[model samples]
Target chain A: MRNQLPLIIVFATGLLVIVTFFIPHEPFGSLEQRFLVWYSIVAGFTMLLGLDSLVRYHLIKIRDRRSGWGYSLVLLSGLFVTLILGFYSWARYQSPFKLGSPFMYLYSYVIIPLQATMFALLAFFIASAAYRAFRARTTAATLLLVSAVLVMLGRVPLGGWLWQKIVSLIDLLPGTNLSGLKGLEVFARISDWIMDVPQTAAKRGIYIGIVLGGIAMSLRIILGIERSYTSGS
Target chain B: MIVNIIGTWIAAGLTIAILSFLYKDNPLYKFAEHLYVGVSAGFGVIYVWAFDLKPMLIDRFIENQGVERWILLVPAVLGLLMLSRWFGKIGYLSRLPLAFTVGIGAGLGITASIQGFLLPQIQATLLPLTTINNIILVVGVITTILYFYFSRDFKGPFKYLLELGIIFIMVSFGASFGYTVMARISLLIGRIFFLLSDWLRII
Candidate 1:
């Protein structure tokens, strides 16, 4: 009954939503919105399950005196403190995310800086990888390298200045008539063309395939062929 | 004024701590990382509660009247039922809410894919191939799509098309990587600016 009931609910809910997509009538349209709202609420509550798992994991580490348990303690302390502050703000101001709230302060100062600097660290790694790994070994590799270089250069002001300098040097030649041409912005134009045409094609093709695959997977889920969600401890 | 100054200093310290990760996996970076995870998770919890539950469920339940008010009990019950995971024997009951969400997700996914992505992309791809750019775009898209079509091995001409498709894909990847690097560099620049100007008052 437990299994079958859920499957039935899945089929019913899935079918209703799918059917209502085609029939955007009075009740069906509003019903879909209501269902979405309900789903959002339910999803919000589901987040507690994740929080439980996180807290439990940290607690287990602390209990076991595991390696990096100190860090886990730090993590838990940060979490609990933030949560306490948030709830306090909620109680006091009726909004946890209110401007000038302590929660907002934490978010702005601690979270924003930590997140930004964390991602910024990747820039060094990417540059290092580009230096070591990016070689023009073959036709495909050469294309990739050239495209990357063009994009990297063209995205900034340096590419334009370099292009202009080169154009000026060429115009210094005996027979060159580069006066009629736009010199500085040529690199950017080429980069834009590459992004707009070939890049768009590649992305569009991949997106189409992904969307088609998603539809198939969604169908499988709705039909109960995909049952992995039912299996857990 | 004092609070803001204190906040800026704290932010600067955290920024430097995170940037210290570039040096090595030291204690400072580890502290920052763990704290970041905890604070982010806590923030997420508060965000979901404030944005989703409070406004959508609790507020609506309170503000509405008659049948509308009571209708919210359905989701509230389902949400409570999800807590059945904590119990051993009745843990399977949690599948109901999971199934409900999954079904809704699947239904939404299918419709959204068709309506939002698939049709629009296909329509956009069907462009008039008058210019060189258009031709390249049309051919690039076709060859890229054909490259993924693995039903049978192409003998002669289609193989070259597949190779061409790969070239386009590689270029796309390269362009994407370049853009990502630019973004990261910009972020790094922002951090430097913050350190120099906001923290040290140099710039």
Candidate 2:
């Protein structure tokens, strides 16, 4: 009964929300807005579960005295300090949190830089991957390499200079329609052509397929056939 | 101003600590990584409690101010039911809320995907067969769609069309890869600027 009730609630709310989208008048429209806000609040609640897992994971590492478990102490300290500071700052409505209150900095100084730097590390790794991966071993690979090279080059000024020189050579041939096509501008034009033509085409087809797949998956979930979320149960 | 400068230095130092991982795994990198995760999680904890739970759920309900706001109880109950997973015997109860979440998610996905992605894309693909560019775009979209069509076996011309589809897909992927490289380089530039201008104050 416990399991069945959830599924039933899922169906009820799911159908209600979908129905509300179609009927955006008066009570139903306002109800849809409320549902969205409620959804976010519920989502907010899920953070507790996430925090629980994180704490448990770190505590276990500390308890076992796992390799580099000393770092776990640093982690716990950072967590508690940040938590207390954040709450205190909010309650105080001080600088950084409230802005213009002076430099009571935590998020701006620590979290932002750390997150940005962590993501930036991907730059080095991806460049390394591209070195080995962009090999032109086949016809398609060669075309891919060419397109990538053109795009990378065309995005910068050097490609424009080189392209202008080539176009000047082509300019010797008079009666040529350089009307819409300007010298050096051709690099950007080619890049745009590749992006707007082949890229857009492939992207559209892929997006349509994705939408269909999404609809199918949604239907599966709505129909109670997709039970991956209920894995343990 | 001194506090702000000190904070910037701290941030700069930690940023370098993370970037040090490129040489090899070390304690500085581990400390930075743990600190980032722990602090971010802590921030989220405070954010949700202060912003969502207290104001939206607890205080509003306790004060009983906004009459219509009681509708929030539905999701509140559902959300609470989700936490039941921590308890073993009542764990089956969690499935109901999970089911509700899944169902709403699916419904949301269906409507949004159709409205946002599928229809607009189809509308855009209906280009005039005028220029070479248009022709290539039209053919490319058609061929790509045909490649994804799994109902039948590709024979003769269909096989060739599938090959053409792959070429288009490859080019698209290559362009995306190039753009990704550009994006990553921009990030690297950001870090370099921080190191030089902000940290070292050389540039």
Candidate 3:
């Protein structure tokens, strides 16, 4: 009965949302918003559930005295301290980041740098990878590598400085105008052409395929062919 | 002034600690990583509770004291059921919310995917083929779509079309990679600026 009830609710609510999109009127009009509200409410609880699971996993590690159990203690302490400070700060000052609040103190001092640094790590790795992978071994690879280099150079401030100097050097040797109608904005113009023509077309094709795939997948789930959402059953 | 300085020091120290992973993974990086995860999750919990649970659920139901709002108790109960995975016996009950979420997600996806992705993309491709750019755009789109078609074998002319599709796809990927490099460099620049300006006071 429990299982049946949920599936029924799913079927009904699913139909309701799909139907409401076409007919935005009356009880159904506000219904789309109401459904969205309900979805978010459920999502908030899921986040709480996630936190609970995180705490429980750490608790188990500490209890079993696993490797780096001391780190678990730090984890638990940080979690509780942050939670308390956050709610306390929110309740008192109505801002998670109110001045003189512990939440603000921890968030600003700790989280921001850690998050930024984590992503910053990617920059070094990507540069190294690009060096190896972008070697011009074949015609296609050469084209790709050249296009990438052009776009990269065109994007940065130094590219503009270098381009102007080259144009002037060339003009001294031979050329009439040195550059033509698209003189000043030459680098940006190339960048725009690359993006607008080939890139947009390719991206659009990919988008169509993705949308079609999504539609098929959604249909599969709706018809209960995709039952992987169930935990074990 | 003192507090801000101290905060900047702490942030700079942590940033350096994380960057140390580039040389070798060590205890400092692990400690910073663990602390970041725990604190962020904790912040999320409090934020959700204060902004979502307290205002949307608790106050609306209890403080307002309305009989009509009592219906919200349904989702409140369902949310609790979602927590039942912690228990061994009744863990299966969580499947209910999972099913509900999946179904609604699928339904919403069906409508929006067509509206947002399919229709607009087709509309975008319907441009006036007057300029060289327009011709390139149209040809590139058609050839690329043909590359993704799976049901048929590419024989004569289709083979060349597929070949062109591959070229377009490669250039597209190259452009994407270039932009990603730009984004990553921007992030690195941010950290460098912070270290120099805030920590060393050398901007």
Query: Against the true two-chain complex, what DockQ does each candidate achieve?
Result: 0.81, 0.68, 0.67
Ranking by TM-score: 1, 3, 2
Q: What is the TM-score of chain A alone in each candidate?
A: 0.93, 0.84, 0.86
lDDT by residue (tens digit), candidate 2, B1-203:
78778988998999999999999999999999999888888877877886787777787678775665676687788788778778889878767666766666777887767787788888887889998888898898988888899999999877999999999988888887777777777787898898899878999
Can you tell me the DockQ of model 2?
A: 0.68
Tens digits of per-residue lDDT, candidate 2, A184-220, equal: 4767778878888898888877878878888988887
Cand. 3 TM to true fold: 0.92
The candidate scoring highest on DockQ is 1
Instruction: Give the better candidate number (1 or 2) by lDDT.
Output: 1
For all predicted structures, in order, the TM-scores are 0.97, 0.90, 0.92
- Top-scoring candidate (TM-score): 1
At residue B129, candidate 2 shows an lDDT of 91
Give the Å shift of residue B146 in candidate 2. 2.1
Off by over 4 Å in 3: A1-6, A172-183, B62-68
Task: Tell me the spans in candidate 2 whose CA falls farther than 4 Å from its real position.
Answer: A94-96, A100-104, A164-183, B54-67
